[model samples]
Target: MTEDQVLDEFRAAEALLEGHFILSSGLRSPRYLQCARVLMDPRRAARLTDALAATLPAELKIDAVVSPAMGGVIAGHEMGRSLGVPAMFLERPTGTFELRRGFRLEPGTRVLMMEDVVTTGLSSREAMKAIAAAGGTVVAAAALVDRSNGKAEFDVPFYPLIRLDVPSYAADALPPELAAIPAVKPGSRAIA
Candidate 1:
């Protein structure tokens, strides 16, 4: 499917959304791209993942696919399956995400990090660091939506199935449509 087609699918699956949402990046926007809406449908999810999988070069030699927990788990599994590699997800423990549950990346393992959406690339970076700490070499990063306009900082190549120019506003800068909604701070908080 084309980029436009993928975006159209995202629009069609709007039921997964709720009241004004503060993205993980701490940016305030009137809308949110709830990937679960598209991921819940196996057929559609396969199609979308296939499109993303095609962008990855065969020579990258990815040994496994890793993604941040919550939103990215399913997408990572789907992409890994499409690429015929094992998949794992990193979850937040304390204040940071780590490879838990006996998950370990062998030395010199080539890993590709996958995400459902790219806002500030904070979570992606954390996942990359974890992979590196485990001795895995990050070959690339993939996301379903790229809203950062390439501003995300990552040492590896980053690819998104859809590139969108969605601008975000701060709490005080939110438009009238979003001004009435309650504000929630973004970031992965630690549980004490």
Candidate 2:
């Protein structure tokens, strides 16, 4: 689908939010995309995941799809379905990502890390560590939206259906207009 179409889907689901908000990265931004809202619709989620799957290297063999918990769960599942592989998520029970709940990746298992959006990409980086610890090799990473504007990076391939340059600011450097509004924490993680 086109970028406009993808944005239309987000807007239709009211997932494209605007206001003073805190992101998982702890950076403040006036715009936020509550991807969970868009993914709530199975059809919409499938559409996006399918698009993401299409971007994968045709020669790449994926043994499983893994994602970090909370945000990446749904997108990972949908991507797994599209790729015909098992999908599992990492949990942060001890303040670090881990492969829990019988989730195991055999040594040399090829993995595709999936996420809803790639902003600062800290979560994806953390997920990679867990994947490596489990002996899984991440061949590539995929996401529905890349709000990092090409700033985020991964050791392997990174793909997204959309690339958006959403503006973000440090806590003390927020724009006066955004600072005037009461900042809301809409993400799953706590502001750090």
Candidate 3:
């Protein structure tokens, strides 16, 4: 799907938000994509994820789809279905991400780390580390939206359904317009 089409889904779901927002990365932005709202509808989630999965290189072989809990769970599950692989998730019950609930990967299982959005790529990196610790190899990663604007980097091939150029700023350097509005955190993770 085109970028406009992808964003249209978010608009139709009312997941595309606007306001002073604190992202999971601790940065502030005027726009935020509330993926939970978009994925709340299973059909929309499937459509979005299927388009995202299609963006991956055809040569990429994924044995399983492992996503970080909360945001990535639904997208990752749908991605697994799109790829015809088993889907599992990592949970941070005690701060650090780890595979639990009888989820295990073979020593060299090829994994596709999935996420709802990639802002700073911190969560994606953390989740990839946990996947490694659990004996899976994260050969590639995918996300529904990449609001990083080509700034966030990953160790593996990264594919995103849409790349949004939403501007984000550090807390101390927010634009005057955004600074005037009270910030609300709409992500799953807490900022320090």
Candidate 4:
């Protein structure tokens, strides 16, 4: 899908939120993409993931899809369906990402690390590490939205359905406009 079309889906789903928001990485932003809302509809989720899968290089071979729990679960599952591969997720019940609930990957199994939105690439990196620990090789990474403005980087090939240049700031350094609004955390991860 074209970038505009991709954004249209978000707009249609009302997932493109505006206001003071705290990202999973603890950064503050005036806007946030609530991917959970976008993916809540099964048909929309499938459409998004299918378009995402189509963007992958034809030469890329993926054996499975692994994503961090909570945000990535639905998108990852849909991605797996799009690619015709097994889908699994990593959980952080104890502050560390790990494969649980009988999820396992054979040694050297090619994996596509997936997420709903990537802001700092921290969760994606953590999820990739957990996939490695589980004997999966993360061949590439993909996300529905990348609001990092090209700042976040990954070792593997990275593909995002849309790249947004949304500005984010530290709590103490928030812009005056954003600082004035109450900040609400809408992500799955909590910051201490």
Best by lDDT: 4
TM-score for candidate 4: 0.98
**TM-scores of all models?**
0.89, 0.98, 0.97, 0.98
The lDDT, on a scale of 0 to 1, for candidate 1 is 0.83
The window of 10 residues in a row where model 4 has the poorest summed lDDT is 183-192
lDDT for position 98 in model 3: 99
lDDT tens string, model 3, 14-133? 999999999878889999999999999999999988888877887778999999999999999999999999999999999999999999999999999999999989999999999999
User: How accurate locally is residue 106 in candidate 4, as Cα lDDT from 0 to 100?
Assistant: 98
lDDT of 4 at 65: 95
> Which is the better candidate, 1 or 3, if ranked by TM-score?
3
Q: Model 2, 13-72: lDDT tens per residue?
A: 999999999889989899999999999999999998998788888777998999998999
Q: lDDT for model 2, on a 0 to 1 scale?
A: 0.92
Q: Give the lDDT ranking, best first.
A: 4, 3, 2, 1
- Report how far off residue 9 is in candidate 1 (Å): 1.7
Model 3 clashing residue pairs (backbone): none
